[model samples]
Target: MEKVQVSPSRTGSHDQSHNAKWGIAAGFSASLVGIGLARFAYTPLLPAIIDAGWFDASKAAYLGAANLAGYLLGALTGRVMAQRSSTAFTLRAMMLLASVAFFACAFPVSYLWFFVWRLLSGISGGALMVLAAPAVLAYVPPSKRGLSGGIIFMGVGVGIAASGTLVPLLLQQGLKQTWLGLGIISLVFTAIAWKGWPKQDAAPVHAVQHPRQSNNTTLKALYAEYALNAAGWVPHMIFLVAFIAHGLGQGLEVGAQYWVLFGIGATLGPLLAGVLADRVGFGLALRLSFILEGVCVCIPALGLGTPWLMASSVVVGAFVTGTVPLVLGRVQELLVHHPAQQNAAWRTATVGFALFQAVAAYGFSYLFSYSGGNYALLFLLGTGAIALALLIDIVASRSVDEAAPR
Candidate 1:
């Protein structure tokens, strides 16, 4: 079927129509595949490649950090420049950059060069992450916005699952060839997405107006919120695999297997959260996911080996990382009247979060070294941060409700 525009007049009817709902879901899912595979697949694959004796594990960790740093920079750039860029164009450009960057990783290069490729990939991946949901939201009607947002994020899970399945299968084909094949896959999908991208609508009229520069209190608070949450999550986010590799003293192959399990769990968490959000509300979904995140991180400490570890991995994957889009959804809801302002605000929040995450990555890596590569403490830290984030969300949601027009 050809792409159907969500006309202003037909917004209500189209929202209820099965075709519109599915189209939004399909588009979001496809974009997620592009974004997630390009950005996230590396975590699982790195260990496999390292175990194959292709590179040092420390270099892989640094490369991951470099990519995240690029992501922070890209989010800042996008928030400023992308407001005027067409959604279709932004999505296509990001995917193309990601595809080429990942493909670049396949050629043997020095550690410094590898970091450069990862950094470029990071920026491309970050741009995709920031743009994908907004593009998805533009196509969805306001009435269905929450549900659509949930479905769009479910794409993250699918991407995670794909990485899990793809890495192990490719490892059988040899490490270098596997990366080359993955790059080819990225390139092919980018082409397909470019061809199928929905046409951009006139920009949505959304922006919250602040009084002519009152102390920037609200903006400052939002930045603080993003920084706090990002700080809490960054340690595990950057070094989870490294923690696993060092803690268990497992070979790269063993680490890859666990990473695959983590991906599988991550995939399921979002879908379940989406369903719950549709039934309850966005705030409740986030809280539940956060609670599960704490449990998931702590459960692996029980020393149950592969099955228990896998179960914990899935639970961890499901809750911890998946709540990000829901957080963005809250930002959208907060600025329903000011689309541009809201977009800028969200971009700002993301940049703040990404920067904190980058800083945390380096700190946590050194901390892990100091602890003699103990991974348990990292999980402990993750659990505490997740608990705090959940509490903050609850408090923030209550404030939003109180402040909104009755």
Candidate 2:
């Protein structure tokens, strides 16, 4: 079969092109605000929050897990919301609520209040991810989806990079000021992006249906692989800074700087992943991502030099976060004829991702305590999980190949 490329002329509409551009920008900012300010900021602030007598070590870790749990809930709830409302409404609402959560934490609240705010912020990140990126892609031309997804997914890295750098610097001003600063930054952006969501004036909200197991084996394989990938990321996302700062005896400043390196990988990851997936097919790209991520996680575990650890950060960041949109892109391929099923698959994938992260967060925190803050061991375990996911992909592939001959 010969493939016909989709050109700009084939894409149709000067207005839709403009809208798609803005839609991507909105997703980028939404990602920046939702994940960068709301989620990643917590990492740089975690040590400070504990040092200030706000919470003990155990509670601090639990807080991280709680935020992840909220994100899981957001995914489940976002699915329900998608059936009832436009993506624009869901995206805007989540972003606004996330900003409010950030702002509320600026007050000298009780522990419960802080937890509530963190959870709300996490909820915003997950819901925005489910709604915002898909909305933008829906407006894009078919040929451009991969690159566009890569562009939009850069938000995770942007957020991570910004928080990794900004939060540590802000901590010099004290925790209260840091919280206020994060809140203000997120709120301002959400305000600007308030009405910017592109209106898909053509499609009705009810066009998409609930997910079906039309391809049960493929769905199961994707879910297992994705869930494992989610767990693989939690160690770094929640504890990498702490490991570098406290475990390595480098202090928070140095940790924050290296985190910026990790963010750099994250920033570059999706763009490469998307383009590569488009060229080579998503299955191979996914395998490559999982393999590299496994290697990246092991660099620090090797007790190598500082530069090696830093290099690993970038690699891990890129592969871990970058792999997301590629997987979603793969889901798009699997359901090319079933557009509604494709959308439902994306939502379900997010839920699976979040559910694993929430569980991994608490478990990793406990492992951190149980092993006496053995950061190296935790990273090693993450490496093993990545390997397992890779193996699952391999098994699924072989099974599919064997079935084809029958």
Candidate 3:
């Protein structure tokens, strides 16, 4: 037999390709554990926690707001943590923290204990959301980045779907056991993703080389739009399950089933939105998403029946997650030549989203208590916010076009 030699370039390409696949897997796991399990699992669990007498409705709602508050902090600090330590180290640590938070939540030792753990879970989720995709995408070939990014973010939808399906079954085992089950699942994901991160983190941005100045007007509008979108989605994110379970007099199981539908929509949202953006342009896709989401979000407020509610769950779920890629794509379009500026714009958008989400959570929680659990009011308000965002985009797009050299 003749010996065959492989060239260095070919071998290096093979290794890079191998590592990129694992990196995408790690990114997916990070999102599944961080955002899916840490943040969304709590939505289904909210009504259960209240029903179990672990906390009164108002208190439990406020506890949900605590996670949003922590998310804001984590979004602001995630990059700093990566810079100080390393992206991989920070991602793994955050996943472990989220898993630990789930276990700690199982006890419900006190309101303070549960609040602290939930907040920690939110922190983990926010950090993972910030760091995971960029770390993985840095290694992926440019041609595949779009699809890879969609696959990674689909973890959130998967996590949401899992909560809708698995949480109900786990609840039957007992609430304590449900928490344990979630923790076990998160831990397994953590272990699986441990070695999947890229051997090298994405190269740090050097601001000195890449000046951050670019279309300021467009960037400001984007930040505002992203923040408003975050605010508008809070009702469904934190209260949909409770509203159905308690507000509509539907049982927990029925509410969980609706959540499953939402999860299914969420799982498909990003991919669908990406394809739409490719066809119609991100700006148009974004505006259309706003219109669809606003209508869906208002269905419950209109006192609609099961079919409408089902449509609401699925459409709102899809738009809620779908809007993400649209917004990111828009940012890329706005700052096409300025990579550093694009990153800065995205960080600003993310921070604005976290800030508005935290504010809306607390504001809505207070409103919910004040209105005597008026779920419809919250839905209307959410719809109003989305409408405002659409209005802003309409105005901003026109202005950007007029300012362009024809």
lDDT against the true structure, each candidate: 0.64, 0.81, 0.90
Per-residue CA lDDT of candidate 3, range 1-406, in tens? 9988889898989988998999888888998899887998999999999989999999999999999888888888999999998888999999999999999999989999999998999898888888888888888887898889889988889999999999999999999999999999999999989999976776744434464476468768888988998999999999999999999999899999999999999999989999999899998899899899889989989986999999999988887778878888899898776766766677788889999999999999999999999999999999999999999988987898899898
Residue pairs of candidate 3 with colliding backbone atoms: none
TM-scores of all predicted structures: 0.81, 0.92, 0.97
Better of 1 and 3 by TM-score: 3
* Window of ten residues with lowest summed lDDT in model 1: 211-220
Give the C-alpha miss distance for residue 112 in model 3, angstroms. Answer: 0.9
Worst 10 residues of 2 by lDDT: 201-210
Q: Candidate 2's residue-wise lDDT over 89-112, tens digit each?
A: 888888888878877876746879
Candidate 2, pairs of clashing residues: none
Candidate 1 lDDT tens digits, 1-406: 9997868767756643544455465455454545457657777776665666767656566666777788887777754445577766766777777777766787767777777877887777677667766765665677776666656666666666677677778868877777787777777766656644456543565444665433333345546555655665554455555546656676555666666666666655556666677677765666676676667666545566767667676676665446666566656555655555766677777888788777766666566657766667766766676677666666766776688799
**Number of the top-ranking candidate, with TM-score as the measure:** 3
With candidate 3 superimposed using the best TM-score fit, by how many Å does residue 123's alpha carbon deviate from the native? 0.6
lDDT of 3 at 333: 90
The alpha-carbon deviation from the true structure for residue 278 of candidate 2, after best TM-score superposition, in angstroms, is 2.8
Q: Candidate 3: where are CA atoms >4 Å away?
A: 1-5, 204-208
RMSD each, Å: 5.2, 5.5, 2.0
When sorted by lDDT, best at the front, the candidate numbers are 3, 2, 1
